[model samples]
Target: MRAAILQSSTGIDPLLSARNMVEAVERAAGEGADMLFTPEMSNLLDRDKARAAGSIVAEADDVVLAATREAAAKAGLWVHIGSLAVKADRGTAPYANRGFVIDDTGDIRARYDKIHLFDVDLPTGESWRESNSYVPGDRVVAVDTPWGRLGLSVCYDLRFPDLYFALSDAGATMLAIPAAFTVPTGRAHWHVLQRARAIESAAFVIAAAQVGHHADGRDTFGHSLVIDPWGDVLLDMGEETGLGYAEIDPAKIDEARGRIPVLAHRRALGAVEVAR
Candidate 1:
């Protein structure tokens, strides 16, 4: 199947932000993509800690979801939203950093709350405390589609290689790493991390990401990419407001695994060690 990965930018206006997403998806659909994936926080790129916390809401009533659902139905394609700020429960907070898979029929097949929270201080003096605003998910999730079993994950989860291995062991053929990676980290680690996962797990890796500056003056390192099981870059969206496409063959997963046999050759280490 053909897939499209969107490298999107944050806009000054929320509605316009949503429009950019719709237009990108539409363009991808017009190009005959069976599936289309958008980056994290596809709606607005508000980086102000206070505003992002207050503004991002996870709800079925979210405009971006509604529009994407409509677009998916109209385009007759499966649309995977990398991540969106969703309002979780009312009377408490605004939302969660969530992602969804909408089938061609406009039905939501799967939903995943970002399991790993981004909380850190960068050398750039940019501090992000994702835990302050959103609740983290407690489970690993995968969903079945016409293509194959798809593993779902968001940005910070990239650091945990074990998660990718687990997904592949569970029969996943493709993994999604949707992110709004900070420019520094993205430039330094994004491609290598993605390539490593594909190499280690023998699964196709699809990463859709944000590019350029957002509403709150935060910039994302955007190089949305699709890598094959053999660590080959099938398609790369290098710093642009566009989409990247690649044809995925699920059978390649078996081929890669059969050749490398990395999963079967593993020696297990017992227990986690405490750092003193």
Candidate 2:
């Protein structure tokens, strides 16, 4: 299976972003990518709380989601939109930071809302409280694909290893992380952490990320990568605002699992007594 990772500059213009993503998908398809992915907040990213509040909408009625589904169908590939802010619940103000998996037929196969909220103050004086604007998802989402079982996650979720372990326990072979990671955090922990997740879970890690500065004056570290089961980056989309592609070999999954039987050597940690 071939994969395409897309990176884009941030903008208030959701329509333009959608168009750019469609074009990128087309290009990746031309390169024979079976799966295509976009970075977090691929539709829009506005740091202004008031602006993001007013601009974000609910559901596929949002033009960007509609265009993405159409693009996925046209390309006949698995299209993963990292995360988009959409309306949730009734008449509520906060939106859902959701990720979607669209199949070749353009049907939404699975959806995962971001579970880990980025609510922290960086040492650089940059503070983010995502929970202030979005509602967290309560469920863990995994989907079965032609390639293998896939686990879905978004930005900030990368820091939580238990989630990946849960998905791996459920037979996930590939993990998707669509993110708009801050430059500070990405620089410090991005690649190493991503590789660690792949190595620990023995699963393929495909992270598509936002790159460059946004209209909101926020800059994201763009280094979209696809790592194999052995924790090797198959494709890296440095700092460029474009797309990258890689092939997925399911046999690699078997080979890695066979070499180190970490998944099989499981002991009942649940029965362990905690030391007071």
Best by TM-score: 2
Model 1 TM-score relative to the real fold: 0.93
Model 1: pairs clashing at backbone N, Cα or C within 3 Å: 57-86, 57-87, 58-86, 58-87, 86-95, 87-95
Q: Write the per-residue lDDT of candidate 2 for residues 1-276, one digit (tens) a residue.
A: 888888888599788887887888789889988888888887889987777766688785777888988988988878888888888763243788989899998999988889999999999999999887788888899999889999999989999999998889989999998899999999999999999889888899999999988888999999999999999999888899887778899999899899987678754366767799
Q: 241 in model 2: Cα distance from truth in Å?
A: 1.0
How far residue 3's Cα lies from its native spot in candidate 1, in Å, is 0.6
Tell me the lDDT of model 2 at 171. Answer: 93
Question: The CA-based lDDT of model 2 is what?
Answer: 0.87
How displaced is residue 20 in candidate 2, in Å? 0.9
lDDT of 1 at 231: 92
* Model 1 stretches astray by more than 4 angstroms: 90-94, 266-268, 272-276
Please name the candidate that would achieve the greatest lDDT relative to the true structure.
Answer: 2
Report, for every candidate in turn, its global Cα lDDT versus the true structure: 0.85, 0.87
Give the per-residue lDDT of model 1 (tens digit) for 98-126.
Answer: 88999998899998888788999999999
TM-score of each: 0.93, 0.95
